[model samples]
Target chain A: MWPPGPRGQPRRVAPTIMNDTLLTVENLKTYFFTERGVFKSVDDVSFTVPRGKTVGIVGESGSGKSVTALSILRLVSAPGKIVGGRVMVSCRGVLQYAPTGTVDLLTLEESEMRRFRGGKIAMIFQEPMTSLNPVFTIGDQIEEAVALHQKELNEAQRWEQVLEVLRLVRIPDPERAARSYPHELSGGMRQRAMIAIALGCRPEILIADEPTTALDVTVQAQVLELLRELRERLGMSLILITHDLGVVAEQADEVIVMYAGKIVEQGTVRQIFSHPRHPYTRALLEALPTFHTTGRLRTIPGSVPSLAALPRGCSFQERCDRVQQRCREEDPELMVMGEGQVARCFFPEL
Target chain B: MGVYLFKRLLLIIPTFLGITLITFLIIQMAPGSPVSLKIQQMGGEGIRTETVSKAVIEQTKKLYGLDQPIHVQYLQWIKRLATFNFGDSYKDHRPVLTKIREALPVTLLLNFISIFLIYLISIPLGIFSALKSRTLLDQAVTVILFILYSLPSFWVAMILIIYLGGGEYLNLFPVAGISSQGVGELTRWGQFGNVLWHLVLPIIVLTYGGFAFLARLSRAQLLEVIRQDYIRTARAKGLSESAVILKHALRNSLIPLITLSGTLLPAMIGGSVVVEQIFSIPGMGKLGFEAVLSRDYPTVMAIAAIEALLTLVGILVSDLMYVWVDPRISFEGM
Candidate 1:
């Protein structure tokens, strides 16, 4: 049971009393009911974000990685409903306001859900150019987020909080950057401002949905480094959703490889990279061109199937190099191959 | 901005000249002169038709300065315009300035009221429809607005007159003119009410099309704006839906409406010609209609010049308003 408090007042968890698992998502299914057909964007996704650690979700486009993040936050809009899910967020973490027990975010009322969003858990989107409101200055937008979550703060205090977050995000000139519009800043700085907005409430969990995807190569590295530094310093769990495997290798402790709206493989970063289990994961790892890769980069045989019209058995059977009769006949459930490693394949590599 | 406005004002001189010069030349080439028209009227009145001979026509033409070369007449008219002199109306020989001044207020009052109503009603209508877009209520509103938009104003005015005015069915409102005959005897407020009552049908006819069109435009613009990424950002910030739409989306959606307001200037000054005629209101539209019918060159030219100036001013105002709503545009470079 949560603390017996009315709305807008979340139970406070002490900073030092940390929970090992900050978030657990169970059987989450978000489907988009469009005119053409129902898109099973995030079908039965299950994951957890441990405190002060990074969980990377990697997949090609339309693989439901981004939708999983949105479902956790309940930010999916019209036509895309979270049909079934339990996004249980543990309050006893480094967060100051998370309740003493886990709360199901999906079932919370809109007002309560609003309090959780940008308060206990925040998100930074991919397109920094468009993420910040163009009409508002950086400081104003951040101040708005702060004012919404931190109700007791006065205007001056909210402004101070904005400047503090800007400084925390390593903006060179906080005062100048605060006064400038989104268009006035570079892509990197805009992303930093976006991060500052997320950091406005000192969230325990930060969801970076392709945070560095829109930046230059150097800027991408810088942003990822900043995120890494911010996570470590703030003791916040991160859900890094991206298609770049190199970023996962550099930044993630755990990796989830998704295909056709389902997780094909999930394991420790080293375990999944060094010894991939599922054929799709193996193909994805093989496709990555390392320094020792002698020939041309390996390409996956086929693309992901449309979620509306997936094959009868395994969704990846058409794309699998090691496909067989069993794979074509029956769908495979996730099987535990080793400690902390799960693969969905009828004939997983030994 | 000041420098830009000064330059715009200076540019108006040439534009004014071009408008007046072309109008004067077209009038000269037109067939109906005051003298021939007068002669025809005299013949129709059963007066001394044979006595209105070539000598009498020549004297009348010379008196009215129509016998001069076209270029000389244009130059003379331009010279008079420099002194703010619009000469006299050929219909009644009244000073064009006095006639326009009398008619200008009525047109301005009616148009300003219509414009005010259009904005007041359509903006909320647009925002509501957009918020409820694709719902049955929104679809119904759309159908109703489209019907209103498609119906011609004159036809609507006639229907309104027959149904709501002093027709056989209702007789609730006055059928013609902007005021009752005994309005001067009433208190000021009473006089105002009488005028407004008489203006109801005409104003309705004038404003229905405008509001319907503007509501649709604002709905479309707001829809596009609410779909933009920044609106999503606002929502992600934990602001309520109202705050996101009213605060974030409304201002961004107003650019199209502001553009339409600029183009509305000519219509504002010219007044609704058919509506004014149907109502028999002594507004600028009715005045200009009579002037053109009687070939009153001075009155027509004066009205054209004033409408042109207001149109230029309207464009400038809307541009300045754009800067107010959206800081991205500035007049400095222009």
Candidate 2:
């Protein structure tokens, strides 16, 4: 829900005393129909993000975190289809369904999707170097994005808008940076340029899929801070998908833990950190190398199960220390563990 | 850049000399001699009073400086070639370089026109096929191009002559010769137009195969560029598909295509020998072929030297262009 207002300040409305759900995804299942048969990449993933907040999705590689983001954007490559799901976005006093309703993104014709993408929702890709076209100057790219969505603006106005967004992303020497090509910019500058392009339109939702994974630790911290400041200042919803727990701890208001193509845990930042019910989530927390830890650090035993041959019960049963016979016989569904917290497990640990 | 040009220029010396040496040795060692062939021709005409005696042939060779040792002849030829002198033709008693120079412009014109036509037709065709890959248009183009690429140039030339030459229903093009009768004695513009008209068939036949090859290569390279993550990024920025293709994908794809074009440049100058023969165009290939048949060592050696120089120039130009298109490339490494 992008409200037409001044650039940086959040608008005030009558306090409804109820959470405003900006996006609601239900039973989202995305599959890749390959020669080897269908591989379920995102199975029954469900999450809800209230307006003006951030949702952090955390998982190891191949854990369906990135696929869920791509599925939401309907950018999954060919042979991979969003098989079953309902992604609803409430924007400008209208409800839009993803795969089944009016303007279903999964089935929307490419021309129609073009109008919504980068206009209503935008994405910041993982590798900034490969994401920006090397031939175009950063300014030209940002200006093009602005003009594509806002065709009514004149060239001078569009350029002004580009400069405004570039400054908003806190890029120094915005004027100079605009004229420089991608190869001329440092890694951090390129990443910031990507963010400027993503936020140029002031879309309803910004999906950042591991935006800082390719940056060094110092740059990662700076990028995370910029994202937090931008999110708060713009009052725009953010879906931050990453496997780094440090990133989540620093910025996420809410968290979703996915394992083997399924969301095994979801909760507020405090709920997830204070008492993680899922064994996988607990193991993930323990695996984090803290300053106190000495000798060999703890690691989750065994690798992630292949999507084609997931365990029958809990997907994490094979790696769970507290696994029982029942945990292996039946798959668990998300059960309430605390206020606004859900974990899928046979026996929730306290 | 000056250093690069200097290096390229330095390379031409050995290349020209090497070509001259190879062509001379090959022609000399071949089973026939120009004196013997001329005597045979006179004998066929009933004008021969005596066979070509070995002593006369040896005397003729001495007069022409061919009696010198191979190394001495090679050194003398190089010295003359350094001053743009190819000595004299033994058969016609004309300057060998002058004859080659007179024929070269005609060959260059035909080859240039053909290459230009090929690029004009092939680039768009290649982009269209790549954009609509696996569709009916792509399939049709692929099949047609495959046929064209596999077809012999000479056969295609003969077919064009039969269909488009005078006396046929089409009668749209000249049958043979660089100019129409009496036009050779006219103004330069008139003579140029006349030569161009006669050149049409040979140029078309020579162009078809290379057009098919370049088109396929361009389409494949464009497809690869289109698959890059940067293209997706451009699309995600809400740029139109046309802008995505033209501004982003095509520019990057041209780097490879430019390299391929450089490789194709010499082919245009070399002129397809078989095609030239079939169409009866007075190009370098036709001259080279005649020199081979008549055992004209000087003419053959001059044409080979020119060809080697043109090829080296083409390659050098292509390498320089690569740096322009992609700044990341360094010619020093090459």
Candidate 3:
């Protein structure tokens, strides 16, 4: 907005997000400093959540999906550091505490960050069974969330909000469910209660980090269904992080495919599923079981490279079918392939 | 909950009887009885005339109800216990109940105050050390507490008496007993302060070991609790670090501490024995010790019976507290 770069010089300027963007994460790098070695958990990952749209980030375990969400909230524990990047959250129409502009969350003080967490952007974890405090009633916990962010509400009104959230999540008998402890509810009901808690503050952006992973298969479907409906009804932007490609295909408008802590492909869900540019993305899609597949299911030839000792050049070079001498010498930058699609490969499938 | 408590209370009866019976039999089987000891004392004084000693021993046995069958004696003892009457102490012909009454308040006072101080200091230290876990300060606290725990209570009491109780070093507190002589002349508040002043050293000796053990226990418990997924969720829910720790984590950690409170009853009587003996405080620990040494059946049995009963009640109270602290534990089934 201020200085123009030298003519024809490639400057690393912040990406432009249109008016509908709710959040923008740019060049986010989260590294874990361990005794053995530094683990580049989320290395130079960037994406955006368009307002009221679901963006699914899919990857295997240790692909930094959860760390990305945690980093967005500045909740990464010690030994892990958000080494570089900007998490610019649009505070417009979010909450009163944040100024009405795009604020870089990484620069905010921890006390100021609290207002953003559970107030503007809330998160729900995978383990619903353990995520809720065992000693507290589901209602009391929800009320705590509401009370912390909604300080304008009195105690009675806060409690009413608790019941309201419980009912919103479709828990039977809101009053009784509020009084019931986490153990008293079934796994599905507990997940629902967790969703209710996350929704208590009416957050503009909801991060569901494998929210259905620990649930039963049937309950998983139900919880996912509830999440889809809740997103539409509340018109909240959701950053759904999961390993399930099918879930992303069914629920997401955009998809970001991560490999070895880096995003290898980013596109519309249909584009990424039908025409994946990166080899890792294609391999993951092939691994998914379909009705027409016969005999043994297809799998990628090798496991993800250990983050502590990632090979030079390309992380996927050892596993890529089209590996070459050039691929061994240089890691490819994320290059635009087709309309609204990008891939981190020198040789795109297209 | 009420039905569960009533059933637990009812179960205490048989348990009390079993404990008392074992203690009574064990004490009775020991080498000497009150009659034999009386005879031995007389003989030791060079007053042993055979016919006179024999007549006196027989009279003593019959008067003390020792001539009855053992089972008959136990039945009589149990019968008296039912009416809240503990027969006379054999060592001194005073009523056992009266002896207990005289000793009970001092022991209870010392123990309750120490217990209160132990929890008050330990709980906060535990929370602090756990919050600052793995830091230099936490490690220092751990090392100091381990040292405190390793030092024997009696040894600590002796050291305190020497250094701070008018021994070789500076005299700061009363060395023996719970009160100054002629303490009644002081005003009421002054009397209380005087007693407290006398108690300072003994209480320090009594309190150090307890707070050491409990602080480590609570620190370990809280360290475990803070790592739980719910604590992470609490932090994610925009709670301050203190709210996440004190509100979300402390209650769960307190479950183990509540479970520990069940053991305090026996510790109240047994733990005080050396402390009371060294300080020369007339508490139940000394009373129980002297009763055992002299084979005073009535006094020993009374103390055993009370200890057993209180232990059962302590366990019950802890179980109820467990339920109160954690909603998951319900005693409805048993």
Q: List, for all models, the DockQ compared with the true complex.
A: 0.60, 0.54, 0.75
> By the DockQ metric, which is better: model 1 or model 2?
1
Q: Which parts of model 2 are misplaced by more than 4 Å? A: A1-19, A93-109, A170-172, B38-55, B134-140, B163-173, B182-197, B330-334
For all predicted structures, in order, the TM-scores are 0.94, 0.88, 0.95
Note the chain A TM-score of all models in turn.
Answer: 0.94, 0.90, 0.94
B265, model 3: CA deviation in Å? 3.0
Docking model 3 quality class: medium
Q: Where's the lowest-lDDT run of ten residues in candidate 3 chain A?
A: A1-10
Supply the TM-score for candidate 2. Answer: 0.88
Scanning candidate 2 chain B in windows of ten residues, the lowest lDDT window is B325-334
Structure candidate 3, residue pairs in collision: none
DockQ (model 2, Cα): 0.54
Per-residue lDDT over B1-334 for candidate 2, one digit per residue giving the tens place of the 0 to 100 score: 6777798889877776777788777777889877677668778889653866779778867776878888798888888887989877767889987888778887877777887888899888999999999899999999999998999877787788888885655899987877888995879988888888888887788788887887988899899988887887787776778999999999888787777677575676665677777777677888888888888878888888878877888888888888778755655633
Q: lDDT by residue for model 3 over B1-334, one digit each (tens)? A: 7888888889999999999889888888898998887777777889764645567777988998988888898999899999999989998889999999999999988988888898999999999999899999999999998888889988888888888878689899989998989999999999999989988888888888777788988999998988788888888888998899889999899888877777785677778898889989998999999998888889999999999888888888888888888899998777
* lDDT by candidate, in order shown: 0.86, 0.82, 0.88
- The most accurate candidate by DockQ is 3
User: Candidate 2 residues A247-322, lDDT tens each?
Assistant: 8987899999999999999999998988999999998999888999999889999999888887788889889999
How good is chain A of candidate 3, measured by TM-score?
0.94
In candidate 1 chain B, where is summed lDDT lowest over 10 consecutive residues?
B262-271
Best by lDDT: 3
Residue A142 shift from truth in candidate 1, angstroms: 1.5
